[model samples]
Structure formats: structure tokens, C-alpha cells
Target: MMMVFCENSFLSYFPNGHIFQPSDASGVLLFIMTGKVLLNVFLLCVRRQNLHQSFMGYFCISLALLDLVLLVTMSFISHFQNFMLLGIRFTKYHTCLLAQITAFTYGILHYPVFFVAGLDYYFTFTQPLNSAAVCRRWLYTATVAFTWISALCYVLSLPGSAIGLDVNHYNSAYNCPFYISSQTYWFSLGMLMIMCLILILCWSEIVDTVQSVKVITYESETVLFFPYDPECSPRDCAKHLLARLLICFISTWVPFVLLQMLIVLLGAQIPAFIEMNVPWLYFVNSFLIAITYWMRRRHLKVTEETLEADPFVSWKFCLVPFRCQYIDKAQKSTSKIVMC
Candidate 1:
């Protein structure tokens, strides 16, 4: 009789105790979303002040706006717990469902966004946009909008929930239902594996290039220049350029890559909402840029237009040396000072 009475009391206190309570998850999401919002704002300000407006600039600004919207929505959902919206009553479960769907949508967006951004870079580098400034702006705006709209529709149309959240009414504890994104996991794993392979294959060239790389400032812009070596053939220069690019990429993304590795090894299930952030997007941006550069390496030129192509990364630095070497030796010193 005592045990039966104790069980009844427990059920009364925790009506849905068997379900994985999202109170802790909601709290963590709010904290992460707040930090991401601030980070994106700072990045936007920095890009506005120091970088030229390019396709990347537009994409980043749009992403920041999206983050702001999500942050606001999550904040309201967390605070009110339950509310009336559009004449429909929404309980905490509905809010969690909304968040889950949005998070999944955001997770799947990474690939499509990267593909479109890569296309933008390809066209910008291959056939420079000769249209008026207004036309170029419109083109970028349209591209970003299309990518987001398409991704959202595709995710929403999927058959089942990307995340599984179960709510039970019994007073028994259950496991957490955090969603670990397979798409993100595999993408990150593939990148790390490919980077490792490149490191192994080009270890010698990377070492030599690191020793030869020199930094020069021209008109307040820093350019990485490799001194011209008469004995170095065109193929050798290409190898060195690849090495330099690898170094730049690895140095900037070491922390992010390491975190991915740790998660992979431990099989940790990070919530999708928290995984999608400014740093991850920038990491993808850099990867796409590097791939584009590698493909167009033979035709690469360090021109004024190329310098303005990427808002976040100064890829011109990698190509400047090739441009500088073609000039007369007598004018090399002056050209180095003026070209970049």
C-alpha cells in the first residue's frame, strides 16, 4: 500500500516524467543562439568596415539576419512556454517541434548553400561579371534567396521528422533525444580525411613553401609573396601554391576540425540547433573557396577584381607571387610594393 501510494505521488509530481524533458536543451539552445547572434553581428560590422561587398558579403549578411530571427523566436518560445499565435494555442511541445524542424532545415542547408556559393565563385572567377553594379547586386540577392527557399521546402517535404522527440506521461526517466546530424558528421569527416591525405602527399613541398613564404604590405593590404626562384619550374610553383593554400586553411580551421574529430570519436550527439553557427558556415565558405582556387589555379591571376571576390579570406595573397614573378627583375622590387 505504501509503495502504491508513493508511485501515485510521483506520477502527480511528474505527469510526463518518462519523456525526455527539453528544459535543459532549451536553456542550452538559448545560450548558444545568443552567442551566435552577437558573433554574426560583429562579423558583419568587420566585413562592412574592412571588406568589399561581394557575393560572400551578401550571403553572410543574409545568414546573420536569419540567425537574428531564429534567436528572437527561440527567446519568445523559451520565455512564454505556452502562448496563442495566429489564433492557435501552442504548448511547449509544439514549440519544441518547431525548433526541431527549423534545426533540421538549417542542418540540411549546409550542402546546398555551399554548392551555390561554389557556383558563384566559379562564375565570378571564370567570366567576371561585366554588368552594372546594380545588376550584380540583384544577381547575388536572387541566388541567396533561391538557395534558402529551395532548402527549406525540401526539408519540410521530407516524410518523417529529422529529430525524434517523445513525450510520455509516466513518472519514469528516459534517455535524451538529441539529434546528431549525419550530414554534418560525414561532411566534416570527409574534409578531415582529405586534408590528412593532402598533408601526407605534399609534406615536403609544404615544408619548403613555409620557409619561402614572405609577407608584404601594399597600400595597407597584407599580401603573402613567395620569392621568385629561377630554378623552380611551373609545376613546382603549382605544388608550392597548393602547399601555401593548405597551410592557410589548416591554420585558420584547426580548432573547428579538432572539435569535429572529438565528436566523431566520442559519437556525441550535439543538438542540430547549436551546431549551426557562424564559424561552421565560414569554415564551409573557406573550403569551397579553396576548391575553386585549386580548379582555376592554372588561370589564376592576382587582379584588383580577384582581391574583392572573397570578403572573409584574402585568397589574392596566394596568387600574388605568380603575378609578381612575370615582371622584369629590375622592376620586381617596385612591382612588389605597388602590385598588391
Candidate 2:
């Protein structure tokens, strides 16, 4: 009776009743996992000095640790397949079952993790706290823990955890089935569409803004600035700067946008487990930060403190270049201005 119920649950993931052989999917998964692990390790090491200095740092370190754990678990699972473990021999079916469950859990985790990271930034900026550093650290830790626990609970509560474990049975050589999160798919699609629209709508403005922008180094940081124009009002200046920033961002992440487009056009069903990597997270992070800056553009002040928030991306360079007064002051200190 239990076997029958499990089989039915597994079959539901494939309503088409067609199970294809895994082919190179397992190899691809392993390669992706390895790359993610290496990237996370490099980031953690690079930022080790400031790993816990800010909420972003904590979030990044936590993500790195999670990626490491997943990589190790997958490696062990692959190693133990067809081997004896505590007097129990693991078959392909058992191996795929474990992989699917793990993939499902990791796949659904992206949203919650990104949400918590955003919240951390939002609260840090909006709700200025007078608490000590220790208290702040504890608060960030609790938020991170909440995201992980909530995501885990939600994944486990789903029927059969939304994984198709029967694929391996049909093809003994099949690697594993991975869950594709609809939430992630839609989120990626929405972001790509929005960026494309923004680029299209503001292409002329962006091009004009980029042409006027000058790049210079201020206090060891690259800064973008434009000469004072009598006709351009402060608001217009801000808009132009923001447009230029978007262009810069889109240029940096053009490959990611193209990949998302290709996936949509080709109807590729990339496993969420493989899609949730360091690059994807950073891409999302930059987009969220850009949105936040745009929302608060009127109130934004180009100061050294504000630029220090994001460790990975130097968004300050984009923000500081537009403030004429700031640029005037910088002109006194440096003479390395160049046109963009």
C-alpha cells in the first residue's frame, strides 16, 4: 500500500507520462555545483575581513556556507551510490530520491533568502537602530535563520515535496530529477522583461547621459560626474544619472538577461537547483539595490558612508558622479577625470 502511494505521488510530476533519460543532466549538475562552491569560497575568502561587518556580508557568508553544504552533500551522495552504507545497499532509485528531495529544498530556498536579504537592507536603512553591534548581529542571524527554517518547512509540507523520484526506475542510468520552481521562473522572467522595457523606453536619455558622464577617481573609489549645465535642473540631473546607472547595470548583466531570454524562447526547463547560483543571486541583488536607489533618489545623499553599504558592487560610483557640488570638491583633490 505504501509503495503504491509513493509511486502515484512520484508519477504526478510527469503528467505527460513520458520519462526521458537524464543523459548529461547529472554531469551538468555536478559541474554547476562545483563552480558555485569555488565561487562562494573565493568570495568568502576575499571578504573574510568583513564577513560579519554588515547585514549584506552576513547574508553572503551564509549563502556561501549553504552552497558549500549542498556541494558536499551532493558529492557524498554521488560517491555512496551503488555502495554499502551501514549494511544497506543504495540503488539508483534511492539515490535519485535523495537528490530530488535535496534539489527541491534548495530550489525553493532562493526566494526566502533573497527576501530576507532585502529586508535586512531595508530595515538597516529606514529603521535606524541605536542598538549595539552585537544586537544588530543577533538580529541579522535570527532573520537568516527564519528564512532557512521557513523555506525548509514549506518544502517538506508539499505533496511528495514536488519531486519526481520514479524517473530513475524507468531508465536505470538516469541520474536524478530536479524540481523547477515556478516562482523563480516568473521572477527571472519579470526582471528580464522590466529591464528590456526600461532600456527601450529610455534609450535616448541613457545614451545622452552616458555621453555627458565623466569618470574620475575620488578617495580610492571610481566616481562618475558630469560638468554643471545651466539648463539641466537637479531633478533632470538625477534622472540622467539614474538612467546611466541602469545602462551600466544592464551592460554588466547583459549575459544573464540573454540567458533568461534564451531559456524562455527555447522552452528550456532548467532545474531550479542548478539555476540558484552565486551569479544569479548577485544579479538579483544588484537589481534590488538599483530599485531601492531609484525609489529613494530624491533623498539620496552622495556620501562616503552610503557607498560602503554594498561590498560587491561599487554603486557609489554611479551615485557620486552626478552631484555637481561633490564633483567640485573632488576637482580640488584629484585631476584624473576622463570622459565615459
Q: Which candidate has the top score in TM-score?
A: 1
Write down the worst ten-residue block by lDDT for model 1.
Answer: 1-10
Please give the lDDT score for candidate 2: 0.60
Please give, for residues 267-294, the per-residue lDDT of candidate 2 as tens digits. 6776665666666776777677677677
- Which pairs, if any, clash in model 2? 224-321, 225-321
| Candidate 2 Cα outliers beyond 4 Å, as residue runs | 1-21, 24-29, 43-57, 80-95, 160-175, 228-238, 299-305, 321-340
- How big is the positional error of residue 322 in model 1, measured in Å on the Cα after superposition? 7.3
**Candidate 1 deviant stretches above 4 angstroms:** 1-23, 48-56, 160-178, 228-230, 322-340
lDDT of 1 at 161: 24
Ten residues in a row with the worst lDDT in model 2? 1-10
Return the TM-score for each candidate structure: 0.76, 0.75
Candidate 1 lDDT over residue span 70-112, tens digit each: 8788788778866767655544444455555556556666666
Query: Over all chains combined, what TM-score does candidate 2 have?
Result: 0.75
